[model samples]
Target: MELNHMTEKSLIRYDVKETTKEKVIWTLVESLYEQGYITSKDEYFETVLAREKVSATGMEAGLAIPHGKSSAVKKAGFAVARLSNPIDDWESIDPNNKVELVFLLAIPEGEAGSTHLNLLAELSTRLMDKEYYSRLMAAENSEQFIAALDQVSVKEKEDKDTYEKTILAVTACAAGIAHTYMAAEALEQAGKEKGIRVLTEKQGANGLEDEHTATMIQEADAVIFATDISPKGKERFQGLPYIQVRVAEPLGKGDELIDRVLNNPDGIVSAENDTESARGSENQPANKKTGVLAEMGQAILTGISYMIPVIVAAGLMMGIAKLGAVPFGLVNEINDISYATHDNELFVILHHLDKFGFMIFQFMYPIFAAFTAYALADRVGIVSGFIGGLFAAGIHYRFWGIEEGIPSGFFGALILGLSAGYIARFLNQKIKLNKNFQAMKPMLIIPAISVLSIFLLNFYIVDPVFGGLNVLLRNTIEASQESGEIVLSTIIAAATAFDLGGPINKAAGAIAIGLAADEIFPLTARVLAIVIPPIGLGLATVLDKYVVGRRVFDANLRVTGNTSILLGFIAISEGAIPFMLRNPIITIPINIIGAILGAVTAVLLGAVQWLPLPAFWGWPLVENIWAYLIGLLVGTLFIALANIFIRHMLIKRGRMTITS
Candidate 1:
């Protein structure tokens, strides 16, 4: 379908009275449903809300495009709504700027790859034009709005001239959505005005689009790479002269960048040059160092992002394996299934699956450390970081006749990764090697020094200290469990739920998983604690709607909350993050309190989980399953009541204004 055919007068609503983003989205979705564009309103709306949770669709210039490709959509269509007042904190690229113009897209699941993407590309291009945006904003009615959209000219590809100085550019950002495309457009527009042929590849959410061929790269005089991330397939431009800058640079100063390449050829940095120096150049703005730090942080996040899939997949597999082993009486006790050959077929299969899960978990530390270091010092830091992680996880040291192997877990891996990365960076920056021996810096010199230094530091200093702390922590938790001290359990539970999968929560989880591995099954309080916060918060969202006599939770958020409960059932605590982000003041405390109560109650009832995984599916494996259920139910109710009370207080104090 054409872009013009996607939009219609019936789909455009000017001067909408909706005060909230949820209300605005639902209004447009309802319009689409009424016009027979969607097969089911609820299904389409839920899909859109799920997409929003991944990342906000709000772009710059007071515009938001919230689209979803779902089975509920009958055909591809677009609905535009101009809000009377902009929605605050609508997760825009610029957080301070609210969204006024919203284009809600509905496309059938089958059409997502072909027609949906084409319409999105066309719409995104039109929205980027200032005149088109201005025309849409000024339109008083649906007819005028349609007319304004009709005036937008579809962008046509510029023919390449071999005689002209042609440049190929790649643009990308962390999200790879708005900034990536905008930079591409700016560069293309700037190239057109300057009589230079510019070919841009946008690496975005939908993956690479309009990719430049090898012939195009070889033909170009210079390459410009504007990206927050390291450009994918960077080696393809190895011999070319290139200028690298932040993705935002091309969006505003594309013309200036093109002139720099055309006027001063030497100004272009070679792709072979040190990428770190190119990205964190001293000649750039004052925030260059800050940008460097942000990049480092992004690297750590990238490692965690990769690690999460392994955790989820392996954790769930182990959980399922344990369920299958129930009838065979395998996994009835801690470490009941031996690694040796088993006689029973079902038991053997489940045992191997459990072993497989553990095998995957074993790589978690090394992967985290490697990627963290990779982010800081690129390829040079990988070996050193991996070594550092191994040292953190398994190094044994003797100090004053006392011998102990440090089990630093995730936190230790994090520190080691950072240390290895920075050490590699320092060696790269400070050590002045001759031009002839520069290759040795990465191959031999850097890795050798980094690995040796990290190993020594972790063994002599870091390990002993953290290892001793680890022992003390485990002993304390064991002692608490022995004494049936609910207070200690409460504290652990509270800490686990406080940040909802942050450092504190992960620390508690790591300790529990470690203890479980060692056959210390009494620490099921931590396992129970992990599932409480998300389930409780989700329950609160449902209860708030029915108990408060008003819709305190937004429609999108309500759907997200239900998803959180489902995730909670599978022992994923991060599902509560969206709710926590919305109202941390109330949500966090309630979550902590609920988790504490649940854990304490479970402890008092002698609930025990032999396996490390926490989920309702794994409930049958736990001792006193009924008591665990009771604790969960009670905690959920407490969290729900707490949420209702807080909202009522906020409304009474005029802090929150409820429309319904």
Candidate 2:
């Protein structure tokens, strides 16, 4: 079999008249079908529309390339349409006077794999030049536009054959959007101008999106790291020739990226042209702190990884165990699950297993949190801080007026671990010993100082913090009680929904976990609030498939939303991020409303339970099991019903389509 390669001259078109987005799309599809570029206009358009439903292909600027690959394509081809006017396609970019150019792309199903990605990358590279794109928009005739495109297409292929030296680059952003991709393209363009090869990767909220082979990265002569966000793939880039830049700086002065990469030290910690050059004096500062943070982060990840499976298994098992322990004839509640029912031997056995499971669950969070800190700071932090957390847990269990027992006391563990890590680092930096005794600092002096500091802090500082937090928790519950339970639920629910498992969501989650530990919130309430976000958002996305777009719905969002619920059971908050990011306008506010309604209403109604697990653990032990069930059911209904309404409007307005 053979293939026909598309050239620049074959891709140019000038007179496109459809002014609206849907009409423009249909017109283009019809044009391609008429030109014998596609097998069926209806089939190809349906495929493209389905993909678009998942996410827009409008990669900023005045450009949108709505495309799909299927067996229906007669040949690999592109239809460029310079839209007479900008059209609204529910894109992320500005709608006013924007997106004047639309590129309709198609390729046969067999050719849609790597070749499609290469073409997309090629198109993206050309779009990176604002000046060049502006010129393309200004072209008065088809011939002029073809000439400009020919230049780009010819220049790209010629550079491919030349011997190119590989350079490593990293692009990151605080938001992990907008500037990350832009910076990557800018650096690649700059390297090409200097006749250098480049392989760049990005780290974002989605974690590492691109993973380059170890061999390719190792082969690079120099590296450029442009970032505001934390770069996680550092271990892989170790000992490489590297220069670091902020993401924005590269985009603003892209031409300088190659120069900076070429001039950087072959193998170094800090860049050669550092602004703090004066600090590199003859008597270089001793006790240089390098890799400490990286090491700590690794430890934390390890602890969390080990703890997650424990939490899920124990929490779920305990929830079912609690059900068996429920007393049928008692007016007063029994703290012990085995005491809740004395008649049924089966219930008694499950209750006993629940006790054991609860104990295991208790250690999951704190142990992992302490370990995480240990990984960051080393043995000094692991020993001292984890001990402090245990002390905090003990204090909570004995004196903080906890009724349900502080099984895990996660907050205590977290504080203890952090304190130990920092105290050790501080002592290591400050204490000066004889040169002969310096070797013992990390093993002896550092640990000794850290443990002492942690012990004292736990007895005095952490205990006081715990006292204050306990009072605050009591006061918050009482105040919400006075104001109606809905208020409390609303606040927590809003936090959970705001960022879709980000900082705000985590804040709400930590609160729920803390309450569950104290037996203030029923095991069921916490589960309902936690689980509803992902389940509701996931449902909303499914119902409003058309408006939400098909590509996103099919490719990335479904997995993200569905998997988030699974993660939620392990107390991870970020699982609902895909739907939130994809349909922020509709999903964000609705999610907040639903969560709050569930939380506040359940609280106001006096839905309380004493369970050994968090709502994040899902089902089973929800506080006032009925309240949890009702809240989740209601929230799901609200989101689904609302999405249906929104979907109808979108379809009626032609924002969503059923036809090609």
The lDDT for every candidate, in the order shown, is: 0.69, 0.56
State the weakest 10-residue window (summed lDDT) of model 1. 268-277
- Residue lDDT tens for model 2, 30-145: 77777777766655676676656544455556677666664456766677788776665546323332567887767454332355434444554566777767767778776677
Show pairs that collide, candidate 1.
none
In each prediction, how many residue pairs overlap at the backbone (N, C-alpha, C within less than 3 A)? 0, 33
Window of ten residues with lowest summed lDDT in model 2: 270-279
Highest lDDT among the candidates is held by which one? 1
The TM-score obtained by model 1 is 0.67
- For model 2, the stretches where C-alpha displacement exceeds 4 angstroms are 1-119, 125-166, 171-189, 192-221, 227-229, 239-241, 246-255, 262-311, 319-360, 367-459, 468-660
Candidate 1, residue 407: how far the Cα is off, in Å: 0.8
